[model samples]
Target: KRYSSEKSHIQGTSKLALGIFDGMKKIHGMGARERLLLQIAVLLHDCGKYISMEKVAECSYNIIMSTEIIGLSNWEREVIADVVLYNTRDFDTFEIMKQRDGMDKRTYLLVAKLVAILRLANAMDRSHYQKIQGLRVVLRDTELQVILDSARDLTLEMGLLRRQSEFFKEIYGIYPVLKRKRNA
Candidate 1:
């Protein structure tokens, strides 16, 4: 189930997004449609890699921005593209904000929240091994805890999540704690 090689990445990513989105909604002031867009962005996050690994992030952004999604408006597509642009690396969030064309605080937060969740969700399946079987997310006052159910060691996934968690923390104002457990 390598993300770079197959369709399973979409399913895995959607699963990761659902858990993260569920936790995020309780902590952020976002609408249901914005949350659903986050889920769609997760599934479409890496479509660029399938086209060319050389510049996957850039390609994915372009593909998403250009594609006419069945249920999404142009603005919705832009939001998804913006979220995908930062999926693989760190970017200046300020620059991202300026591109929103005078979005209100809540809409800005919605976009940021989508990007943050997408980052963590993608990292949850890092190494492209798809070892994670389930995820439980708990948002506390000071930190966000993600409990992962897996059959094997999750060292890679944890490390990636930690790296990506910085953005999550920046957006949501909570440190991220990722752990693996054998039993539910």
Candidate 2:
């Protein structure tokens, strides 16, 4: 609330992301620590938009690194910051990330996974309208089908989801498909 002008978007996106993380926890091999980082990253992801919309990712990274969030070690903060940093930017491959400073292989992969989830959640609320009333995420074979329950038109959200799905597929080996439930 202090940094984000679009509180609904932040809240909605956080809800969606946490839900996704929870649903995929077993398959994704992410536990409580990753979930905590994901939550914090989603919360502060757009805080940089408070400074510059065009450079939100960079600005958010700077802001998060500068702030001393309690209970988080410097490394944990870096994980969250990088997650926010890559929210809009295309993530580097694992080898490219290995050459970067600060994060180890485990942490780097964690950041990438969180970034993937955050990007998809952010896309679901791109209009900041919270059009999706409910959703059920299911991993079926090679697809992560997000069955949405909403009466509103979702062309924008669906299109953005399609665009974001590639990264998700690259990270998880499962394509994300958004399907509107017929009766809902």
User: CA lDDT, every prediction?
Assistant: 0.78, 0.89
TM-score of 1: 0.87
Which regions of candidate 2 fall more than 4 Å away from where they truly are? none
Q: Candidate 1: global Cα-lDDT?
A: 0.78
Q: What is the lDDT of residue 113 in candidate 2?
A: 87
Please state the error at residue 136 of candidate 1 in Å.
Answer: 1.3
Tens-digit per-residue lDDT, 129-159, candidate 2: 9998888899899988888888998999999
Model 2: residue 16 alpha-carbon error in angstroms: 0.6
TM-score per candidate: 0.87, 0.95
Which runs in model 1 stand beyond 4 Å of their true positions?
A: 1-5, 95-107, 182-184
